[model samples]
Target: MGATVVQLTESKKQIQHTHRTFDDQTKAFRSNPMPSISERRENLKRLKRLILTNQERLIEAIDRDFSCRSKDETLIAEVMPSIQCINYTLKHLDGWMKPSKRHVSMLFQPASNQVHYQPKGVVGIIVPWNYPLYLAVGPLVASLSAGNRSMIKMSEYTPHTSALFKEIIEGSFPGDLVSVITGEADVAADFSAQPFDHLLFTGSTSVGRLVMKAAAENLTPVTLELGGKSPAIVSPDVPMEDAAQRIAFGKAFNAGQTCVAPDYVLCPSDRVQAFVDEFRTRFSEMYPSIRDNDDYTAIINERQYARLQSYLDDARAKGAKIIEINPARENLGDGTRKIPLTLILNTTPDMKVMQDEIFGPLLPVVGYTNLDEAVHYINERPRPLALYFFGYDRGQQQYVVHQTHSGGMCINDALMHVAQDDLPFGGIGDSGMGHYHGKEGFLTFSHHRAIFTKQKFNSGQFVYPPHGTSLHKMIYKLFIR
Candidate 1:
C-alpha cells in the first residue's frame, strides 16, 4: 500500500512536469510569434542533417524494435519520405509563406485585401508503432516549416526506436522548440489531454476515438491518420500477373504492417485462381525463403503475431480457403515470430479477416463478377485510406475515380501515391480525416490571417449614418444595385 502511494505521487509529479514543459513552450512561442524564413529553413536543414547522419543507427534501432525490420524498407519507407518531406517544404517555403493578394469590391476601394499565413503555436503529434520515424518527423517538418514548435509522443510498442528518436531530438533541439515524450499508454493519455494548438494522431481507429475524446476537453483541433481495410481492385481487363505482383509488393512490404497497406484484393470470379497463382509466384520470387530471408520482415511481437494467426484460424474455421504462400516451406520454430504470407480465398462477409483491418501479411481475395460489383463491394465498406486500381484503360480509371470516395487513389500501382510529395495524404469518414502533405500540411499547421490595409482617404465619410440623407441616398443608388 505504501509503494502504491509512492507510485501514484510520482506519476502525478510527472504529469505536472509535462504540463509545465507545455506551458514554458507556449510562453516561448508567444514571445517570438513569427520566426523568419531563414530561421525556419535552418531548422529544417538541421533536422535533415540529423536524419542523414544517423540513418544507420535509426535503421538498426528500428530493426531491434521489430525483431528484424529490413534496413532497405526503413530507408525507402521511413527515412526517404521524411527527407523528401523536408526537402519539399524547404523548396516551397518562400511561396508558402508569402501573403496572397485578394480582390476587393469598389465599395471598399480604399482598402486592400490579403491573407497571411501564421504559425499556430505548439503542435502535439502522437506517433504510432509502425512507421514511427516517418509519422513523427513528417508532422514535425510541417510544424517547423510553418514556424511552430512541436512535442512528439512516441509509441510505447517501439521502445528502442522511440528512445533513439528521443535522444536524437533532445541532442539537436531545445525542449521548448521540439521535445520528445516517451511513455506507456497512460503517458499517451496524459499527452493527448494536454492543451495544444493542434494535435495529430496516427494509429488505429479505436484508439483514435479515445484521443479525440481526450482532446475535446481542451477544445484542441485534431488531425487523425487512422487505418481501415484498404482494398485493391484488379480490373478484368488488366493482366493477372501485373496486378498480383503489385498487390503482393504492397502486402509483403513491412510484413503488411503499414497503415495504407492493401488489406484485400478484389479480383474477377473467373480469374481468382490465376491471380492467386501469380501472387504466390511473385511473393516467392521476392523472398525465396521466409525463414532465412533478410528481405522478409518479421511481425513486431508475439502478441501481434498471435493476433494475425488467430485471424487466419477464424477465417479457416469458417470455411474460407487458406493458401499459405511459402516457396521454401521451411520450418519456422517455436521462437520465431514470422508468419508465412497467406491468402484467404472464398472469404465471406462473416469471416474475421473480412470484418477487420488485417495489419499482417494475410491477404484476403474477394471475387467480383464485374467492375461495378468490385466498386460496390468497396463502397459498402468504410472508405479506406488508400484504394488501389490496376488497369490501363483511362475511362475505367476515370469511372473508378468519380465513383469512389477515398483519401487517396493509385492506378496501375500500389502504395506509390504516398511517396508523391505534392499529393495531400489523408482519409475521409471511418478511415481518417484532414490532410498532411505538401501544401496541405503547411495549411494544416498554419492559421491564415486575413489582413486589410486602408489609405488615409475619407471615402466612407460620405455614407455616415445621418438618418438617410441625400449623400446616403446617392451612395445607395450608385452602389446598392
Candidate 2:
C-alpha cells in the first residue's frame, strides 16, 4: 500500500513537471516570439556540435537500450542523417524565411501583397523508440529552423538514450527555450495533453490517434508521422537480384524497425521464388551471422521481441510459408532477442501479419499477376508511409506514380528517398498527414501570414459599406466583368 501510494505520487509529480515545463516554454516563446535568423542558425549549429561531440556516447546509450544496436547502423541511419538535415536546413533557412511576393488582383491595385513565414511559437515533439536520436533531432532541426521554442518528449522505452539526450540538451540550451521530458507511458499521455502551438508525433498509427485526440482538446495543430505497411513492388522485367537486394536491405536495416521499411513485397507470380532466393542470398551476404554479430541489430526489448515472434507464430499457424534466412544456422533462441530476416510467403489477408504493420525483420511476399493488380492491392488498404517500385520502364514508372498513393516513393530503389534532404516526407490518408522535411518542414512549423500594405489609399474602400454608389458601381462594373 505504501509503495502504491509512492508510485501514484511520483506519477503526479511527473505530470506536474511536464505541465510546468510547457508553461515555461510558452512564456519564453511569447517573450521572444520572433527570434532572428542568426539565433536560429546558432541553435542548429550548437545542436550539430552536440551530436558530433557526443556521437559515440549517444550510440553507446542506444546500444545499451536495444541490448545490441548496430553502431554502424546508428551512425548511418541516425547521426549522419541528423547532421545532414541540420546542414540542409541551415543552407536553405534564408530562402525559406524570405517573404513570398504574391500577385494582387487588379481589383486591389496599388497595394503590395506578400506572405511572411512566422514561427508558430512553441512546438511539442514526441519521439518514438526506434531510431530515437534521428527521430528526435530531425524534428528538432525543423522546429529550430522555424524559430520555434520546443519541448521534446522522449520515449520511455529508450531510457538510457533519452536520459543522456535530456542531459545533453539541458546543458546546452535554457530549459524554457528547449526542454526534454522523460518518463513512462503515463507521462507521455500527460505530455501529449499539454497545450502546444504545434505537436509533432512519430510513432505507430494506433498511438497517433490518441495523440491527435489529446491535441484536439487544445485546438493545437498536429503533424503525425505514423507508420503503415509500406510496400515494395518488384516488376516482372526488373532483375530479381536488383529488386531482392534493395528490398532485403530496406527490410533488414536496423532489423526492419524503420517506419518507412518495406513491410511486404509484391512480386510477379512466376518470380516470387526467384526473388525470395535472391533476397535470402543478399541478406546472408549482408550479415552471414546473426547471433553474435554486432552489425545485426536486435529487437528493442523483450516485449517487442515477443510481439514480433507472435506475428510469426500466427502466420505459420495460418498456413503461411515461413523462410528463415539464418545463414550461419545458429540458434538465436537465446536471450539475444535477435531474429534472422524471416520471410512469410502465401500470406492471407486474414492473418495478423498481413493486417498489422510488421515493424520488424519480417517481410511478407505477395504475388501479383501484373502491375494493375499490384496497384489495386495497395489502394484497397490504408495508404502507406512509403512505396518502392523497382523497374527501368519509364511508362510503367509513370503509371505507378500517377495511380498509387503513399507518403513517399522510390523508383528502382527502396528506402533511399527518405535520405534525400530536398524531398518533403509525409503521408496522405491513414498513413499520416502534414509533411516535415526541407522547405515543408520549415513551413509546417510556420504560419504563412498574408500581409497587404496599402499606403495613403485603401482600395477596399471603393466597395465599402454604401451600396450602389456611383464610384462603387463603376469599380464593380470595371472589375466584375
Candidate 3:
C-alpha cells in the first residue's frame, strides 16, 4: 500500500512537470513568436552538431534498447537521414521564408496582397520506438525550421535512447525552447492532452486515433504519421531477380520495423515461385547468418518478439506456407529476440498476418492475375503509407499512379522515395494525415496569413454599408458581371 501511494505521488508529480513545461514553452513562443531566419538556421546547426558529436553514444543507446541493433543500419537509416534533413532545411529556409506575392483582382487594383508564413507557436511531437532518433529529429527539424518551440514525448519502450535524448537536448537547448518528456503511458496521455498549437505523432494507427481524440479536446491541429500495410506489386514483365532483390532489401532493413516497409508482395500469379526463390536468395546474400550476426537487427523487445511469433503461428495454422530464410540454420531461440526474414505464401484475407500491419521481418506474398486485380485489391483496403510498383513500362506506371492511392510511391524501386529530401511525405485516409518533410514540413508548422495593403485609396469602401448607391451600383455593374 505504501509503495502504491509513492508511485501515485510520482505520477502526479510527472504530470505536473509536463504541464509546467508546456506552459513555459507557450510563454516563450509568445515572447518571441517569429524568430529571425538566422536564428532558425543556428538552431538547425546546433542540432546537427549535437547529433554528430554524440553519434556513437546515440547509436550505442539504441543498440542497448534493442539488445542487438545493427550499427550500420542505425547510421544509414537514422543518423544519415536526420543530418540530411537538417542540411536540406538549412539550404532552403531562406526561400521558404520569403512572403509569397499573391494576385489581386482588377477591382482591387492599387492594393498589394501577399501571404506571410508565421510560426504556429508551440508544437508537440510524439516519437515512436522503431526509429526513435530519426522520427524525433525529423519533426524537430521541421518545427525549428518554422521557428516554433517544441516539446517531444519519447517512447517509454526506448528508455535508454529516450533518457539520453532528454539529457542531450537539455544540455543543448533551453528548457523553454525545447524539452523532451519521458514517462509511462499515463504521462503520454497527459502530454497528448496539452493545448499545443500543433501536434505531430508517429506511431501505429490504433494509438494514433487516441492521440487525435486527445488533441481534439484542445482543438489542436495534428499531423499524424501513422503506419499501415504498405504493399509492393510486381509486374509480369519485370525480371524476378530485380523485383525480389529490391523488395528483399526493403523488408530486411531494420528487420522490417520500418513504417514504410513493404508489408506484402503482390506478384504475378504465374511467377510467385520464381519471385519467392529470388527473394530468398537476395535476403540470404544480405545476411548469411542471423544469430550472432552484427549485421542482423533483432526485434525491439520480447513483447514485440512474441507478437511476431504469434503472427507466424496464426498464419501457419491458417494453411499458409512459411518460409524461413536462415542461411546458417542456427538456433535463434535462446531469447536473442532475433527473427530471420520469414515469408508467408498462400495468404488469405482472413489471416492475422494479412489483416494487420506486419511491422517485423515477415512478408506475405499475394498473387494477382492482372493489373486490375492488383489495383482493386489495394483500393479495397485503407490507403497505405507507401506503395511500390516494380515495372519499367511508362504507360503501365502512369496507369498505376493514376488508379491507385497511397501516401507515397516508388516506381521500379522500394522504400527509396522517403529518402529524397525534396518530396513531401504523408498519407491520405487511414495511413496518416499531413505532409512534413521538405517545404511541406515548413508550411505544416506555419500559418499562411494573408495580408492586403492599400495606400490611401480604399477600394472596398465603394461597396460599403449603404446599398444601391450610385458608386456601389457602378462598381457592382462593372465588376459583378
TM-scores, each model vs. reference: 0.96, 0.98, 0.98
Worst 10 residues of 3 by lDDT: 5-14
The regions of model 3 sitting more than 4 angstroms off are: 1-9
Per-residue alpha-carbon lDDT of model 1 for 210-257, expressed as tens digits?
Answer: 999999999999999999999999998898889988999999999999
Write one digit per residue (lDDT tens) for candidate 2, span 112-229. Answer: 9999999999899999999899999999999999999999999999999999999999999998989898887888998898889999999999999999999999999999999999
TM-score of candidate 3 relative to the true fold:
0.98
lDDT of each: 0.91, 0.93, 0.94
- For candidate 1, the 10 contiguous residues with the lowest summed lDDT are 7-16
- From the highest lDDT down, the ranking of the candidates is 3, 2, 1
The residue ranges of model 2 lying beyond 4 angstroms of the native Cα positions read: 1-7
Candidate 1 or 2, higher lDDT?
2
Error in Å for residue 208 of model 2? 0.5
What are the clash counts of all predictions, listed in order?
0, 0, 0
